[model samples]
Target: MGTDKRHYKEPKTLPDKRNKRPPKRFRRWRLISSSKAVGRFPVLVETIFVEAIIPDLVITQISNGFLHGKIPAAHLPIVDRPHLLDTVVLCIAENPRFTAPITNVTAAVGREAILTCLVEDLGNFKVAWLRVDTQTILTIHNHVITKNHRIGVTHSEHKTWFLHIREIKATDKGWYMCQINTDPMKSQVGYLDVVVPPDILDYATSADIVTREGSNVNLHCKANGFPMPSITWKRETGEMIKLPNGREVANVEGNFLNLTRVSRQQMGPYLCIASNGVPPSVSKRIMLVIHFPPMVWIKNQLVGAYEGQQVTLECHLEAFPKSINYWINERGEMISQSNGRYEPLQKSHNYKTYMKLKIEHVSQSDYGKYKCIAKNALGETDGTIQLFAIPKPSKLLNGIDNDLQDQAGSLLQDKNYVNTASAASRKFICTNFLLVLSALHRLQ
Candidate 1:
């Protein structure tokens, strides 16, 4: 037994292969093939994060749950140390995806606006903010790339990114993009709607309108705003508006309110209202006026005045432009205010006028036909009133001093029936004389 133990010896210990570093090419290949961390372009891993990945690979293993990439390495155990590479590899295992979609943002002008993009498992990929319509890059990662000083970018926990716009303007409204620089360029889009209260363009819109009756008229209302406002035409007095087809509506849609043939019934202040579901809708007041020639009408075509009596003849006139009103005698002479017996007066409201001719001390000369005339830019019109003498009952009774005088006086005192008959006969004689004179003048 002592002789067999003499040749025993300890075997040589072999070096640990896991502790030895592999070749540079072999390490790169291992990182590229074994994990999706490097992806197609390995260089991106070195540039994306705040704590960038080292180009030279650092051997590490997971500890607890968190990567603890920034913590001191001296505190971690050698067997269970953690590094940023583990974080990259974990994030790479699950591709970047939008946790929540970017929502459409409505912002008022001159106000601050923020747009957020939420992502998960972003890994070494980059997040960029872009203006889709303009193809302008606003921000890349944590840096603002646009020259606009109002723009800014912020990131939170490597998951949420924000693009801030200060003092937003009308030009900033459009489609915005939140993009992830992935293999196929992952992207999500949202609209930036800048809401502005309706504003009517005064130059293009209609002002106070003055057109002739039975003429075509167009009222235009132009507005400038986001979402393109809609225009409505309405009466300011809350009256129903009449359309070209004879249909009446409370409110008419479209920018132009076309009236095929305008009339006096349609003259008033029209409201041009503009709205697009925004606050503080705007409106403009446009006055529409209808114009026509002068016209005259008289209630009584024949008037009677006795000797030593006073009488007033009246004429009602309508005209677009203010008309000059006066009274003319049977001899075609305009009645003058200088005369102490004849007084011509006129009162007007809008397009209507009341013309009066007061004849004091109505004698035989005043008992004849008188014309009330109205003159304007459009045309002229006149109305005639026949003035005839009505005999006084006392004078008629005195003229007949016979037996019938008592009967005539009694009848005249009862109801003035005799005077009424005499007035009728005088009016007939005057009318016949005027007709014969008119015929003779026409022949001449």
Candidate 2:
């Protein structure tokens, strides 16, 4: 045995494969294939999170971190940790707690909004902030994906994730989410309620409206604010509005007010009010103006006035823009203001006007057609009246027989008449009158 042991050379310790010179490619392959850390990169986390797989790739990722202990858990696949899952029923008992709750946040326009999500034992996990309404991702851990420059994000000690939104807008009011990357991913929702007073948009809403009568009136109103303000129209004068079809209303609901066949009755200041239960309800006053041409009417179109007597003519007119109202003769000449002999008077009440023409001593010249004229920049119109003379009565005649006898004797005395009346023709009329007078005396 001593002699055999002397021959044994310590089994010439086999060359250590690790220390031996190997092919570069084989060494590189071994280095890559053997490392659990490197192998971890190829596993798709989304698939593991969505579907079940052997070894629970998420657990494996947590067990073996990818980038050698960088604080950023991004390098490690986000997966449901077994401990949190194991604590499910017990979680109620322990309530893997939140350091601070995700609470309701209120912010004004052009201001900053901060939503905080803080938790304890949030180990080896990620927090994501999302908008509940749109399901929009606002923040993920330390990253913010919102394209708006006003959006930002921050985190503290891997336990708190904050979503900072700058220059908030009216549309930014809604629910938000704080999510933890875990199996059955833990999530908490927070509401971000934005508040803003109402504001009117130019060019979109209505201004002062100038339209003609018998035309369609389109009044549009637009507004912007948080909580989505509604628009309503009301008359500033507190009067009811009459629709085209004779419907009367005090307040109309909608952004657009359509009144067909508008009339002067529809003219006034209309208030467009917008309110969303926010502070300071706002309103805009738009004037609805109506315009039309002048018109004239003569109540007494014809008149019979005795000669040398005073008579008056009258007319009524309605016009906007304050018409130039006056009287004209049949010749179409504007009657000039004269002495008491020819006078014209006018009195106005809003759109209505009264006109009168007085002739102190009415004559044949004043008896012809007369006109009342009304004119404005919009248009002109006129109405006419006519006058005539009444003839004077004759005085009662006396001594009718004497006058007849005298007239007959004068005719008989004319030599020309005697020659013209040949034969017995001249006696015919004379004899007939004499016989009629004798017969009347006998009857009496």
Model 2 weakest lDDT span, ten residues long = 86-95
For candidate 1, report its TM-score: 0.55
Provide backbone clash counts, one per model.
0, 1
TM-scores, all models, native as reference: 0.55, 0.42
Backbone clashes in model 1, listed as residue pairs? none
Which regions of candidate 2 fall more than 4 Å away from where they truly are? 1-192, 244-246, 302-313, 320-322, 336-351, 356-368, 386-444
Which model scores highest in TM-score?
1
Task: Evaluate all candidate structures by whole-model CA lDDT and list the values in order.
Answer: 0.72, 0.65
Candidate 1, residues 262-377: lDDT per residue as tens digits? Answer: 88778789999999877778999999998899988886676655687777887899888778788889999989989999889888877889988888888998888999988888
Tens digit of per-residue lDDT, candidate 2, span 28-125: 12111122333323222111111112221222232232222112222222224432221100000011246677988998777899988887766545
Error in Å for residue 133 of model 2: 16
lDDT of 2: 0.65
